[model samples]
Target chain A: MGPQHPSTHGVLRVILKLDGEWIVEAHPDIGYLHRSFEKMGELRTYTNGLPLTDRWDYLCAMTNNLVYSMAVEQLLEVEVPERAQYLRVIVCELNRIASHLVFIGTYGLDLGAQTPFLYCFRDRERILHIFEEICGARLTYSYIYPGGVSGDALPGWLEKVDAFLDYLPPMMREIDQLLTGNEIFILRTRNIGLISPEQAIDWSLSGPMLRASNVNFDLRKESPYQVYDRLDFSVAVAEQGDCLARYHVRVAEIGESIKMVKQCLAQIPDGPTRAKLPKTIKPPAGEVYARVDTPRGELGVYMISDGTDKPYRQKIRGPAFVNLSILSELLPGWKIADAVSILGSIDVVMGEVDR
Target chain B: MSEEEKLENTETSDKPLKPAGKASPGKALAEVTPPDPRLLALAELLQSTFGDAALESVVDRGMVTLVISPGTLLDTCQQLKTDPALSFDYLACLTSIDRQDHLEVAYNLRSLTHKHEFCLKVRLPRDTPEIPTVTSIWKGANWHEREAYDLMGIHFQGHPDLRRILLPDEWEGHPLRKYYVYEPDDVPSEQGPPEHLLIQLEGVE
Candidate 1:
């Protein structure tokens, strides 16, 4: 028997085979939120698919849109203006920060730590406010277009972002104090659900999951998509692939992302945010697998075009989907509470998981 | 019997030497794949190791996709996992294409050690699409396999447990397939009851 809670995030039913209090087998049942976004892409025009990408990873909508647009640009062989690339990097990093804040905040709530949740949401609200001012929507800003952005930055949005960064460190500290060193938090995470380096590699764990096992893999640095090659930031990694290591990795990653956002503000130049293109976009007949580092991990857009306005086929590689696979392998030996915590550490977005 | 056993062992032992590609130890996805020499060596390794099980194709992005027969998928995945030169330790993604003509499952394999990326594809008939599961090789394939099985209707032969993933238990069809269609039934016209309705009521009384 396992926790049969419905609102437990997308009708996730975990089948547990228990050895006394220890789980011997754990299986996750997903697809409750499957909207078939890929198939929908085939039916939608190139420009129309941007909004669908937003729904792919609801939490990291900007990043999803950016990845899709990047792939489209690749298929079109269009070079975006330098200014637009900088803007893309800035917004993507900001979205990454906001996404991590949700991860920390919700993870705290899941772990029974209420204070951190409020603290995280407080900072997240500021980020969302910034997003709203620029794109008119807070959560799913489908502002990114094929060549550049749909619009320019709003007045004083950069200054507001700087202020948010200035104010965030203190809030982050409070969250650290509230959970990082707490004895119970440590006990619950320290050596539990330990995934070895070899196992982590074998499982195709990316983002923080792979980083927790000491592999410093960040797609921004590796692939250098958008304006990432111009910006400088460190990839935060941990030697232990335990739940505690994953938590620390995400917290450190937020800090690094903040540093990248600051660099973007300073390096961004004055130019057109969007490129001149026709009302209809038709990319060449080809396929491309354009990847970007989202808040969760690597978000890839594998698109096949038939020299038409719509795609012949499109597949979105959701990072959460791949990361979620480790659940069954890791959850089998832990108690129910630990299972939830382990899942929290993996940081799944059911939207992406089912997409 | 002893002579035949000796010959079989030599053939297995004389398998081509797998390429030992260079790797940046600490880098994750940052590792690069050396072209030509390394890729050619990898192909040779596959040919000797799996016999005629490997089928190679060139995709639009200059990506090389290797196709494996369903019977050898599990064992082939195991070899890719353990082979040092072609250390495809990471299962980057698992997806199936719902081609109206035929169903195809694709695996994006990444070597975290050397940072090389490769793909594996397997095709199945529309009626009975099935393949061996690689969840045992890479735990990350669990949901991916399920999603492929659910939406694309491809059967994973050895998946520990396979069930409908994205659709509800009572849902009728796989939505991603090219042939999938959503149709609604005819609804009756809304109008006032006729004199026959009143007559029937009077008869019942």
Candidate 2:
């Protein structure tokens, strides 16, 4: 209904044809936040382009940086050090938790549960503090780069993360108690915007959206990148494929991320974080598609290098962009209020969608 | 578990944790590594099925890429999706590239059941970059094809609602094209709201 409506979540305007209170048809009119990052990637060197990735899907900037770096690393044919790989996994998973926390808080606010929103942000702030210690920025941390992370973890940084991890589970339980099993929340979300597994797969729905529909396709488990294969965790899935199921999958995933981060910290080795490379980064002429399982879904960076400092072509397959496309197919036949619930479950950041 | 125990457990696995980069410095990345047998077998199957339509196939960076002629794009995609052995149901990505000489569209397809993925490329002449849409084969191709059409100026023959996606409908010149020049003066100055928007605004109160 708007490019500014709070319930629509960041510059998503949907034109709806309504029959009384029910939507007859819905068309999502996106692209209000297009910055043309691909064009910018063409104009910058490989190292300079890392900051550009931080802008897309700003909620999980670490994973965005990780995927772009992975693509460049593949083209450069460079190996990241063992400790740097572990650091990448730790930060990416922590960012996943932070991003999901935003979803939980905002989704609660969208569904008229204000207390859970406050509780979620309270916990999310602590995670941001941890991120700030590591990267000096809370939101757009270009910490993960090609060949390695920007810097090694400072002394006692691991202890702070461990302390925060211990503090998080109890707070998460408080949020779960506040919203997950509440009668009003269940009434608003259960069976609303139901997507069948077949429909989910055909539409290329990913992350919690696809997993909620019973599709067990997680890029981390299926095709491991960084140190994901070393960390042991389960993919969170729900069979219902409704708004409630999506909520459940995300809540469960936060727990899994916590477990993975714990594993990364426990097994991190003492070594250099950044790899030695030439001053100029010019990857050989080839194309490589590197994908990472972000909090939202698969973030794939398709890069073609012409053996030059600048990329010949770069395309980002943002998961939120693809996941939000199903709104036009799913919105009809539901009431206008249910539209808010459905859109919240999709959890799209317009920066990624419009990029 | 202790750190040493974890290290020992991981080291015992035959498969290494890191996938070593195959390309040597200053060497072409695609030329260094030999094609995987599985990829070769899949390429053979595609070649046997499509004959001359499958122009060339190569394996680079552990991904098999099949370059097909634009004329056989739709039929080849349909077979790729429905074929039991190569049930590429998931269209992971659709990207269009301006190669300066010619326009190319790449389809990154993955089969959920088989857990194997590959790339399908279609080359079109720069003057008339047109190809049949694969929306019938994969519904997710809707926005992807629209995006390719919007940024790269590649026309999809059968896209149901092909329009400018990221850029405005009235915007001229696809910016992703290699030859496109950005003119700062092209930016429209501030003006009154459009007639339709004003009409909608009149009913707000």
**Alpha carbon deviation, residue B54, candidate 1 (Å):** 5.8
**Native contacts kept, each candidate:** 0.48, 0.40
TM-score of chain A of 1: 0.97
lDDT tens digits by residue: candidate 1, B1-205: 3244234323422131121233233321111211223455555555676667876544333245678777777878888888887778877777688667888888888776676666787888889887778888887787778777777778888788788767777877777788887542233235534566767757877
* DockQ of predictions, in order shown: 0.21, 0.24
lDDT of 2: 0.86
The CA lDDT of each predicted structure is 0.77, 0.86
Q: TM-score for candidate 2, please give it.
A: 0.90
Candidate 1 residue-wise lDDT, A1-355, digit = tens: 2234622544466778888878888777777777778877888898988898888888889999898988887676555666787788888888988999988888777777888888888889988999899999998899888878988887788888889889988888888999999888888888877888877777777899888988878877765666665566889999988989999999998899889989889877777776665578887686667788888888887777888899888888888888877777788868877887787888888888787
Off by more than 4 A, model 2: B1-37, B184-205
Q: Which residue pairs come into collision in candidate 2?
A: none
The numbered model that scores best in DockQ is 2
User: What is the iRMSD in Å for candidate 1?
Assistant: 15.3
